[model samples]
Each structure stands twice: as C-alpha cells, then as structure tokens.
Target: MSKINLKKILTYGLVVFFIVGAVGNLIGPEKILEDYARWGYPNGFHLVTGSFELLAAILIFKSSTRFIGSLLASCIMFSAILTLSYHAEYSHAFIPLIVFMLLLVSIYLHKQKKLL
Candidate 1:
C-alpha cells in the first residue's frame, strides 16, 4: 500500500488502541488494578493514565494534532514497557512495545507529511 494509506491505517488504528486503553484504565478492572498494584503504582494512578490515553486518542483523531498525540502515546507506552520489563512481565511488555513502535512509525509518517 501507499505511504498515505499506511499512515491513515496506522493513525486510525492507534486512535482506536488508545481509546480502548483509556477505557480499560478508566474502568479499572480487577486484573488491571492488581497489575498496577503489583507495579507499585499509587492507588488511583490508573485514572491519570486513562485521562492521558483519552487525550491521546482525541489528539490522534484530529489530523492537525496526530503527531503530538503519537508523542503523548509514546510516552505512555514507554512507561508501560519499562514497568513491565522491570517486573519481568515480558509477555505483558510485548503489546506495549509493539504499540510504541507503531506510534514511532505514525510520528515519522506525520513528519514526512509535514504535519508536525
């Protein structure tokens, strides 16, 4: 596929990904709560994460702010990767790592498009 198409696909896909992440964190399901606790995060930290994820999703959905959104998402994904890796939760780390890489590509595409 063309770069334009690829970028569109990645951008929309990331928007969806962040939206889901935001909801999952905001909902604070038992498994997620336990994971956050296991990672030594303060109680209610998920709220902050969810808020940022939601912001990223919003920014990403807008063409004018896609790069900025990707940057914000990259930060979150990086933190997740670090936390998971530090805890030796490699399996859990995998998804964040993949998302982080996709965010990087999305950012690059935005830069190439001079949308940054």
Candidate 2:
C-alpha cells in the first residue's frame, strides 16, 4: 500500500481505539471501577478519563487537530505506564507503553507532513 494509505489507516485505527477506550471508561464496568479503586483513584474518576479519551478521538479525527490529539494520547498513556509501574503491574503497563510509542510515531508523522 502507499504511504498515504498506511498513514490514513493508522490514523483511523488510533481514532477507533481511543473511541473504544472512551466508551469503556464511561460505561464504568465493574472491572474498570475496581481497577481505578486499586489505583487509588476515587470513584467516578473513570468519567474524567473517558472525557479526555473522547476529546482525543475527536481531535484526532480532524487533520488540523491530529497533533494535539496525539499529544493528549501520549499524556494519557504516560500516566497509565507510570501508574502501572508504580503498582508493580508490568504486564499491564506494556499495553500503554506500546500505545505511547504509537503516539510518538503519530506525532513524528504529523511533523513530517507539516514540513513537506
């Protein structure tokens, strides 16, 4: 596939991932609630996370705001990695770490596009 197609696919994938994450957090499933509690976050903290995720998704869906969306995603993933590491959840941290790297790539791609 062309580079443009690859970039578009990646962008769409990230958007969908964030949207799913937002919906899951907003739904506040029992496991998610338990996780927040375990992480020392107060109840309903999921709402805050969900809101941010939703915002990120929206920003990412717009080419003009994609960089900001990636930045927001990077921040969220960084926090997740730190929290998991502090709590000795290395396995859990891996996913966030991967996402963090993906966000970095997204930012790099955005910058490259800006310069071209």
Candidate 3:
C-alpha cells in the first residue's frame, strides 16, 4: 500500500479510538468512575475530559485542524500518564504512554504532509 493510505488508516483509527473513549467517559462506567475517584478527581471531571476528546476527534478529521486535535489528544494522554505514574499504577500507565506515542506519530505524519 502507498504511504498516504497508511496515514489515512492511522488517522482514521485514532479518530475512532478517541470517539469511543469519549463515549466511555460520557457514559460514566462504574470502573471509570472508580478510577477517577481513586485518582482524586471530581466525579464531574470525566464529562470535561469526554467533551475534549469528542471535540478533538471531530477536529482531527479536518486537514486544517488536525494539528490542534493531535496536540489536544497528546496533552490528554500525557496527563493520564503523569497521573498513573504518580499513583504508582505503572501497569495502567502503559496504555496511556502508548497512546501518547501514537499521538506523536500522528503529529509527525501530519507535519510530513502524510496525514490530514
């Protein structure tokens, strides 16, 4: 497959991932609420995070706004990593770190004009 096709696949994949995450946050699953409580965040904070994720996912689909979307996504992942690490939840931190790396890759590809 061509490089552009790869980029499109990655971009769309990230968008879908963020959208699903947003839905999960908005839906306020019990485990998710428990995690937030354990992390010392207010119960309502999940809604804020979910809103940002939903917004970022929408912006990521547009070439002109993809950079901003990636930046927002990266920041969110970074925050998760920091929080998880601070709480000594190293195992949980792994996934956020991976997500952060993916966001970086998306940013790099966008800069290279491979993705929107």
Candidate 4:
C-alpha cells in the first residue's frame, strides 16, 4: 500500500471538517450551546457561533471565499482555545486547536502566490 499524498489528505480532511461541522450546526445548534455552557459563555453566543460555522463551511467550499472563511475560522478556533485554556479544558480542546492549525496551513498552501 502506498502512503496518501499530503495535499490530498489535507484537502479531504478540510472537506470533512467543514461538512460535518456545518451539518451539526444546522441540525443541532444545541450542541454548540452545551459546549458554550461548559465554557461558561452566555446563552446567545451559540447562535452566533453556529451561524459563523455554517457560513464558514459554505465559504470554504468556494474558491472565492476560502481565504476569508479560513481567516474567520482561525479567529473562532483560537478564541475557543483561549477560552477553554482559561477554564483548564485543554484536554478536550486540543484537537480543535490542531485542526485549526491544519486549516491555516491548508489555506496558506492553497493560496500560494505562484499557484493561485
């Protein structure tokens, strides 16, 4: 068996991330609300976060909006990291932080000056 190409793997990873996360938000923003509650955020924050996640998912699928979407997502994930870190929930939040970093790298690679 051959190793998967890094770029292909990253691309698929991003697609899965956005699609699954968007569906989760669209179907049950309540889960996000629960997470916010765990982090002690106000009730209304879940709606805002869910909305952004949905929009970001759409943007990420489009070539024109990928950069903006990735940038906004970077902000959102970093905020989550900081909030969870403050509450000492690093164990649970670490995966999201790593995913965000991969998203950032994917965005950089996709937008390479010479390529796009």
Candidate with best TM-score: 2
- Tens-place lDDT per residue, model 2, 1-116, is 64568778878988998999999999999999999999999989999999999999999899999999999998998999999999999999998898899889999999999999
Stronger candidate by TM-score (1 vs 4) = 1
Candidate 4 residue spans exceeding 4 A from truth: 1-9, 25-32, 113-116
Cα-based TM-score, every candidate? 0.93, 0.95, 0.91, 0.76
Candidate 4 or 2, higher TM-score = 2
Worst 10 residues of 4 by lDDT: 22-31
Ten contiguous residues minimizing lDDT sum, candidate 3:
1-10
TM-score sort, best first: 2, 1, 3, 4
lDDT tens digits, residue span 15-100, model 3: 99899999999999999999999999986899998999999899888889999999999999899899999999999899889888
Q: Quick one: how many clashes does candidate 4 have?
A: 0
lDDT at 100 for candidate 2?
A: 90
- What is candidate 3's local distance difference test score? 0.90
Candidate order by lDDT, decreasing, is 2, 1, 3, 4
Residue 25 in model 4: lDDT:
56
Give one digit per residue, the lDDT tens place, for model 4 in 1-116: 99878865775666677667656655666667687788887767665776777777677666677778778777778887888889898897887799889888978977894386
Query: Looking at model 2, which ten-residue stretch has the lowest summed lDDT?
Result: 1-10
